[model samples]
Target: MRLRHIAYALLMATALAGCNDTIDGAIDVSKVKNKVEQPLPGRIVAEMQKKNMPRNSPIMIRVFKEEGKMEIWKAKADNRFDKIADYDICAWSGKLGPKVKEGDRQAPEGFYNLTPAHLNPNSKYYLAINTGFPNRYDAVNGRSGSNLMIHGACSSSGCYSMTDAQILEIYAFARDAFRGGQSSVQLQAFPFRMTAENMARHRNSENFEFWKMLKAGYDNFEVTKRPPEVNVCEKKYVFNQQAQGSGQFSAAAACPPMSTPPALTAALASYEKEYQVAYAKAMDKLDGKLWYEPTEAERKAIVAEKRKGRDLAYAPTGTSLAAGKLVEPEEFEKLMAARLAKQTAKPGQILTASTQASAAKQGRVVLPGTAPGNRSTMSVQTAMAAPAPGAAAPTASQTARPQPDMAQATTTGSVPVPAPNPLAYAAVQQPTETEGKKPFWKFW
Candidate 1:
């Protein structure tokens, strides 16, 4: 029995040795030998100096897929981080969502950290850093994918691809940080800038709940300008806290008594207070209308209204005035008279206050800065017939529907037209249709 135990111990020792060798062998130092020897770029060094940041300070990377931008942030002496540089991603695959399975061609989105073990110096793509997919949160969700990378080559297949030149500079940044004793570098991947406006715009998206959770970490960083310490518990990301007793965490286990530094708690509270004020202001600016699909009834009403306007604008001759044909002959005579009067009027003859007020009461869409003679076809025929020197201005009901100003139209003799008061058109409101049915779609 003693001999058998000795043999078992020897086997376990051999297996451990083999595992270590395999891990070490996976790294190809030859591929990065030249880069490791080369000095950091002069521009980057100069930027660090200007920011008063020391060389070899810790770094964080942020990738915004929608903007196709990658930003590098480095720690300063004050314990805060500042953006050092931004690079455009040469290429990427898939759409704006997290990768779920292998062969899906989707890029993963979440907070991931990388160590030297994640680097691939011998990549076919000039240089590559494996994004450690199937992270704690992903694993708890049963997601599966592998070998996802941020690499050089200007080509992507489930990766963020950068130009060779850009990668060399990026690779150098990482190497120096690692050499300076940074055990790991955090990488925050986001779909876009997480602003209140953007969040409101995507409020009805399917992934809104997930995005809200991501925003917590995003907000933390935004307030402190430092990476939030992230951990996974109950399959959800918890920021800047740790289990009280064990001082350890498990992605699938219930979270232990967690606490945040008092200073961070205070800062986050202040940030949330300010954010709430701004968020309310932003929401108030919106008209509370979903910009997505309209109801069937609303669609039909819009179509009918457009058709009715078209018929009124081009009615046939002899139609009753009540049936939407503004006495055609009288309108024609008015247009001709306006044209003749305009040709003879003095350049300095501005419209009188009462005339302008009458036009406003008429709901005529006036192009404020346009020359008096420059008017739309309908305006010339009805609202702008250059009233004879002392003639009365027309009332609101007397004019036909307002038409677009000719001065602002895209034509040969176009000129700048002043913007109208936004509130002026607010008087016209479309009636809402009540379908009396529960919505079939669920945003959550």
Candidate 2:
């Protein structure tokens, strides 16, 4: 009976062991179902420069807000950029302005870098690009809050957004950066390319002079091999700040003297003043920047005004206004067509008279009475020349060509003649049929 008990106990223990195994198997299947996959690291390793990327080289990324573009470059031998890839980007939660703080929904402008600690695989946005770069200046001056990431698609609360495919490629690039010996990556985001033409167009307001300084710093770095120094403590942007010298060397040349006239400067200022406000408002909308969410009525009014103005300025109207004042659309088109026809007409050709005689009244020389045998209807100089003393003026070509009607000639010092239609002349004067009927044709 004791032996029977022992055998029965052993059988029970074996069954319990099997039950444990079954439970473990079920858990394994559950884990597989919930698993998140990451692409193999360094799939695009061949594109990187082997020498410059030690076991861990630092990478650099630049995002241009206005262009909606991003560029990735690896440090290369001779201390230059070897472009790895470029990606289209969607940025920020808010419009074109620099992000001031958390939940402002604005994307921060200026430079930041990536750090290993910030990488998150389980990010709500899928994959996240580590931004370890701290703007030492920003941190020191307390400009912006931290943890900026360039991550996967899911509209940015403040990060740069890329589609899943793009993030995969980026992940591989980052993997290569780590394998090559990059400690961290640098990211610089800017509102736009700080070009002189662009700045002059948008930076008209007194408030925007600050932007000019920032643009200068960006431009200086573009030419020099260094990141600009932040003199933010001094409340100014510093130019040509040095990075750690990699034994590269150069000296900047002296700048040339300015030759722009004061008048030209004033003219440009005037132009900017006239157009910048409307342009800025349009750009703000395009960038999704508005202080308060506009009501439909307000939005419609602004949009209509912009559309009307833009259409008037650019569309091919049949008529034009003498001044930049508003005119009825149809009338403007007619006026433009008339003006163009007037400009294209032969010097002596007469046009139908109209009350709007501003150009002629302003001492514009007018064509006068036609002279006999003259190819042009009138000699333009006759409008200015005094009548010759006691000289019987030669009759006009119209008088010569048509039957002399003394009454008409005496009243206006000119006579009207029926002019041949040019198109009719072209049709009648085409190469005669006889010209095509050569003797060779007859032989054939």
Candidate 3:
């Protein structure tokens, strides 16, 4: 009788965790409309069997903000997790940073968990899974936000958003995991892949120390290929460890001395050693330059380029900063002027944006969720790439569902039209350097 009561309590807790949204009451998920629930797709079911994952196994999720991907890892027969699928994030608000407070419009970054209560089948934007932001770590660190979610709609305010179809599939994964008796699913969110090279690039970011802490847990999972047990103490995250004494872990209080198994420590140390070497190489290559968003003049140039139909939809790499800080300011201006001169010298360039603007205007971007072959028709072709006057009227493209002003894009924290697309960017062939023109180098 006692065991039964305990189990019921645990189940109730699991059912009620992290649901501070508009959910009224739980509905029977079965016998629902296809919009409210869907069975695992047959293709996914077959992949699970091939990978030795159970139909309703526990799962883990990891999100990369810059990459705009969400990966699902399911438990295999051995109880170890294997990545089952990666879903494209159609939209996520904010630049690469953690949400600090309400109304910041920044998506959160850190460890969170999803429980049965987190699922909202009746969500306004198809189904949704609340992210349970301001987790213990966020709470102790003084972060504030509410109702952040992973949901359908391909839109975002301060949550990871996916296409309606993608979220339906993801919603199925969460539902099945709960049915499998998993109490909660771990959700790890990061600004980008915690690669040493990325770290070196962000070495000067205000959040470097916070990110380094996150990397510890990330490293733990990388070495073991399993989710690390996360606990917060002294307002910091401590992973895969236990207090030395009987002291309880407290998010706001100091962490008691903790201990880890020697084997785990050894593995993590080995991983870190390799990581350190990579970090050194990256730092050396970057040569102490830190990345910043485009300056005022650079953004104006981008605006001008778009007016001339330069395919700012996926602008060439270094075009982000108008080649800022890289070349001396005067030299960079000269570069920009020369490039503009070559562009306006053509008739076709002025005619493209109006034609392109009449496209379906369905918020076209080729991310993981796009049903392949939907790439923007604008691959690199040299047309007359002129610079418009700084005060030129809205481009022909602007007459359609306008791409947000680049400055508003930066201020609002949404990934802009011309932002970096790392997943497929390696295939973007770079332009060759001519005596008067520079090649595209740095990416946004």
Candidate 4:
């Protein structure tokens, strides 16, 4: 009965108001071409060194949906990962929840791993890294999806997409790690950062239990600064646990007796103790609070507007919007204008008439009732800059649309997406690792 209900939900998912994805066929991954990709830009390498991160060290990622941020953490001299940068997510489909079935249109929230074979060099949306969803837990729980990717398109449909400039840097990071003999990279996707306040704010969410299940992994990484060894047993995520006495794990079968590292166990106890106190106080404040839950009319109006918007084109026309969200057009243009400047400052690119014209308004998103940006686009000379070190972050917008950092003007339209096949492009030419130094992730 439970399985039947889920299948029916997937079928009605598009029609239903809460679901964002529509059921689609298996996504074909194009074969990687034998192209010699560019190396990591010199400035990025310098930035890594400034942060005490090796230029080609192993990296881990964490994605927060509500925050619309993707943080890259790299191994340092101590072998513990430290955050290197937080790149804004251009677009991610669906709301704050775990993807339950195929076509739910939800960006998955859980642990994923990517290997060299998963890199799609010749992608329709620039470079892409396949997020290997439906790991043991998803399969055991009967969820279904494919080709859910973290890619270089400023648009999404059941994927976490980013600006082309962003993906270029990101893709190089993974490529360098692989070159340094790192086998795989870990990505932890969450509905939002697992701060107690964030969890409490969404206490009424239908996916709270699942988010809590994911929180264990979130907490593990927080305390240890390492990706937990993710395992699944009895249809649940089991993180950083070693089975007692050679006990193995099977997704659908019962979990064997297991134990966590003593340090993690101790650290987690302290972390949870603090989190619980904060959560309880937050929940108390929520009691009897009068929150702004939009009416049915408002929700429909917003959904209709998104359907008409430019970036939301990849989503199904009938896809529903989540409650209590509205797009802020004015500020979006400013930030996008800034991003365009930075991406375009790439060396040796000739701009033609069409490109120059497109460059004038590259990646502009038009939402209903929102006025176009009156300010002129930043010139190549002006936009080629990053936010100053230790500067305050951008103000949080009501919603984030794909105001792309236009790395190239050609990224505007759809191109031929290649069929998934073996990529040649140097499958694994191991770069010499630092003598006697294993990647920090390998320690755990």
Candidate 3 TM-score over all chains jointly: 0.62
Candidate closer to the true structure by TM-score (higher is better), 1 or 2: 1
Q: lDDT for each of the candidates? A: 0.57, 0.41, 0.59, 0.59
- For every model in order, what is the number of clashing pairs? 0, 22, 5, 8
- In candidate 4, stretches whose alpha carbon ends up further than 4 angstroms from where it belongs are 1-36, 290-444
TM-score of each: 0.57, 0.42, 0.62, 0.62
Shift in Å, residue 91, candidate 4: 1.1
Give per-residue CA lDDT, model 1, range 187-272, as digits (tens). Answer: 89986677765554434334545666777778778977877767776667777663466445556676667766667667766776
lDDT of 4 by residue, 297-334 (tens): 33345446554655643332122224443223345344
Alpha-carbon shift of residue 163 in model 3 (angstroms): 0.3
Task: Give per-residue CA lDDT, model 2, range 1-444, as digits (tens).
Answer: 999999998987685444322222221222222223332223234345344544234456777665566787666655455566677663344444466555655566765544443456567665776453234334433445455677765346566776555665566566555545454455667766655334432331222334544554454345433333232323233332222223211111121121223433344345434434544444334232111121112323433433454423221111011112223334433543364355545777554433223332221112121123221211322211211111135224111111000000000112121233221223222242347622111221
> Which residue pairs overlap in candidate 4's backbone?
21-104, 21-105, 22-103, 29-419, 29-420, 30-418, 30-419, 341-383
Error of 3 at 361 (Å): 36
Write candidate 3's Cα lDDT for 340-384 as tens digits: 445343655542333232221211111111233332212100010
Q: Which ranges of candidate 3 are over 4 A from the true structure?
A: 1-32, 293-444
Clashing pairs in 3: 94-413, 343-384, 343-385, 343-386, 344-386
